[model samples]
Target: MGVDGSDRGEGAGQLLADGEAQISLRQAEIAAAADALRAGGLVLLPTETVYGLGADAANPAAVAAIFEAKGRPRFNPLIAHVADLETAARIAQLDDRAYALARAFWPGPLTIVAPIRDANAVCDLARAGLDTVAIRVPGHPVSHAVLEAFGGAVVAPSANRSGRPSPTTFADAVAETGDKAAAALDGGPCAVGLESTVVSVLEGQPRLLRPGAVTRVQLQQIVGPLAEADDDAKRSPGRLALHYAPDAPVRINAKAPEAGEAYLAFGGGAGGERVFNLSPTGDLAEAAANLFSFLRAADRTKPSAIAVAPIPEDGLGEAINDRLRRAAGFIG
Candidate 1:
């Protein structure tokens, strides 16, 4: 805890000011980040979706520090990142559907929640002592390299303080987590910009716990129909009623921005003095990656309220709306 927050350093709060922390996508930096994880310390690394505060998944003490660093609730389980499918098979009991999806989307942004085997090394604290574990193989090269170098599972949740938007850039990761990370690997901006699409295959049928860049339609093709996970399940991560909130109140699906409101437009510009467009060309993929960054920008303007343009509830839009609904709860 003295330097790396290793032995229960929940006190490793934000120590660096704005622009003070830096992470470059270099071999030396990646090697140092991997070393930190191996030593029971936390490091912020890039993923295809968003930056994650990574810790040794097999070490309960290291996992606890992740909650301490982000002030994240213990009820939410963390996702285990694996280097390859061989590593994932050792941790989870992969069924036919699980095998199908993993083959379709490994080394990508899809998280599969499967029944945890007794042989798995992931700690109970990382899975909230549940029988199921959420697992994914990130597509980002930086994350993949670190996982290979670390040589074990790493539980990585979004690298942001609880209730705030996830960090999409290295700067964003530093601004949110501060010196909690012993080191960070800058892999530029995240491609998806949202968390992974979590599919729980624990039950008889497949369930979609959280939406991301992976569209519902794509999953349907491989596994017929998908059911939305129950609210009482509490088995998956990112299921809270109020999450990804900014400092200011957020209002979604506003036909037009009211007076004194900062408009957050999706397809085009909103008729407001201050406006930030998610995707002017109506591209859902681009909008998904830009969601949190734009929200953080709009919050800095100190508007009376943040009004959002209507977003289509298809494909990546589903994930975008999910975050918006949770952020609006900041007002409720």
Candidate 2:
């Protein structure tokens, strides 16, 4: 298979030799990555959403390594990535609602938070000592292959350091956390290019903890009207007020960029080195896929601040604007 999860071609072998993604390394790299995780080592692997820094979910020491590597707060919880729904059921108690959502979105980018059925399956440190556990079945071929090879749950958060934009490309993932990993499997760029939509089903009605590739509209169609995350529902990650931020200050809803500001345009009214169009034709999905990558690129220029065009608040736009607001230090 190719690094992008497609069929390998003539130049496939050269990818590994040139230190790019190894087209033939799917099975070999997955095996090595799983071995590292089983031995309490960190592995940088790709997911459809973003690159993740992964460790054995059951190993407290391994889980701690992830926290230390990312400089993530101990209070923030981690999500366990499983190969299939069956594996998720073993660790988390799935009610009818959780099962319904899982059946519809598993092997995709939707995380379900539920009561812990087997506390030992995911360590207390990984769960932040909460009775609830957040679990997801990632759709990325390389990540799924590693989970299948590891034969258990793995806690994988975005590979980048805490409070930074998530890594979407293989190069960005490696630049962020490659030094701390024992192995890495580059699956090229992420398809979804955003984190999983997290929903907590521990109470009467499912609440949306964090938005991502899976929109509220899509989730509501499966589980009825969703509730917002309350104070007690702090079991999910990405809750920091100033999270997913870059070094430069972010200014949203800008009509035009100033002399020294980097511009993140949506519809098609910007140009030059500092200007990056999320989507030339105003497509939300394309905008989301380019969000973090463009943010990182703009930050590299050391601009005074980054100016963003206004994004509508419907469908995937909610998730995109959610990250933008957080980047600008306006939302939690």
Candidate 3:
């Protein structure tokens, strides 16, 4: 359970005592959460990557509510979460590459962008009026259960305000979106704490738009070469130049801590008055999962500057660095 299950028990109980609107993330309440979505209400649920603020993808009003809740720009698109491949195929025009990628990476971290079929039920607001939709089938059981129960596409963006750190733990999900969301479900900390890797296939080439757990090497193994996105490449969710930022000023590729700066260490050998290590053992996957949480923690210190240790661009590190660069407000 999330808030209803001893997460900030005092606050939850006080809210309950006040008889305000609140719900739990326990197994028994999945149906209620589904019902909320079916009625055009917003819900925050766990995913393998991170918690997502979700609404029915086919509901334009619901989609607009998400934009309002997150303060997200209407120009950026949202990823539609589906229960299964058949559900995905019904909404997007998938090709051979798309099929191969789905077979290999569905139920995992990967969002495939493809043309929306004329028969697609997803509303235009969800797709930001684009002809394509970014869709994925998350592997988290809680997310899967919700999707299966809801029995339709859910457009879920990370459950945080726009340009803020994405919530990985259930506690943070509830903390960030408790008031705006109808309910926030806790499935535990996310396995892949970063967002999904987004690839665009609408241009007839598999272009790497955003990196994640599924590396370009792995995608190429199934779909041949993946190209770098162009300057004018169609924007998807999380494509902003100044995204995933924290309250403090962020500096990336720091070899050592600057005086008075809070340092986010990747591996061993980083020292600071305020420090949080992403991975002390030099494991990139672990670092990827720890990136945003550590940043959030470091930001809490109210440090003069948040300096991040250099992360190698290998495997999941590419995705981690992608987020870091964006958080640091570096586009190139």
Candidate 4:
């Protein structure tokens, strides 16, 4: 079934007779989807942060298939999604600091890398054969249900192909994975359209690997101040210079341009080559929610360049700036 639950038109209905290809509110349908995942099949499941293409983390072959399906780089590690603390501990070797952070942020948009003895057994591809495995317990009932029902950790990456925008809705997931996924459990749009903030705790000090819904401040409060990723670290995964970018070229400006450039502002602005207000009233949350959607829309114009007004470097604005900077190919 596709992400929308529509049959792939391959007569695979018999394989997923219990609402596999259709949006269903019933628990039985979710269970059926979970059953497919347990059988070493791919399932599109929802997380609070974004939709994920999930497979049993304990199965190396299954984990490798996820990389093959997404065309993701082998060096780019995958996160092990679990139902609870116990499940997360089973996959990764958690320290006291890791445990504290997990207890505080489990079922939320936070991922932590911890040392593992047999990374190959649980998920060789998930850790990329590294000593550490990134693990998290997502705060979505559908994801949790699927993981628990499968009775094991599930290796999940954003439900999109490599180097594409993450999918926030079931429709987007379908557009990304299509008939390849066994089933896409639509739990509704994600609250946080971005990915989880990944913090690596395997080392002596916590390091911020990636930023997302979980802010640096929030993480600081739980764990001590973290070392921001340097140039080398930023080159990893979705943090590449030209990543998370729209089809159009993007430019960032201090003030709204008068003409000749698309005026993307944080507040009021006149329309020109193109106009997109991150927030008409200067609301950061609103801007965050509208960022990707606007980027997707603006890309359709096929403009020569996209100009964006500067946003305050605080709160959600920080995350927005991070994405824009990367999109603009500014690694500095």
Candidate 3 residue spans exceeding 4 A from truth = 1-27, 118-120, 271-273
Write the residue-wise lDDT of candidate 1 on 29-94 in tens digits: 768888999899998888878889999999999999999988999989999998877899899998
Model 2 regions more than 4 Å off: 1-25
As a TM-score, model 4 comes out at: 0.84
Candidate 2 per-residue lDDT, tens place, 1-332, comes to 32332111112122223423443455676788899999999999887788999999999999999899999999999999998889999999999999998877766778899999999999999999999999998766677778888999999999999999999998998899999999987777776677888999977779999998778988898899988999645788987878889999999999889989999999976678899999999999889888999999999999999999999899888888888888889764
Candidate topping TM-score:
2
Model 1 poorest 10 in a row by lDDT? 1-10
Tell me which residue pairs clash in candidate 3. Answer: none
Please give, for residues 122-156, the per-residue lDDT of candidate 4 as tens digits. 66667776667778877665676677677777888
lDDT of each: 0.80, 0.85, 0.81, 0.71
Q: What is the lDDT of residue 128 in candidate 4?
A: 70
TM-score of each prediction: 0.89, 0.93, 0.90, 0.84
User: Alpha-carbon error at 111 in model 1, in Å?
Assistant: 0.2
> On residues 254-302, what C-alpha lDDT tens digit does candidate 3 reach at each position?
9877877899998887655698989999998789788888889999899
- Model 2 vs. true fold: TM: 0.93
Error of 2 at 42 (Å): 0.2
RMSD, every candidate, angstroms? 8.0, 5.0, 7.3, 7.4
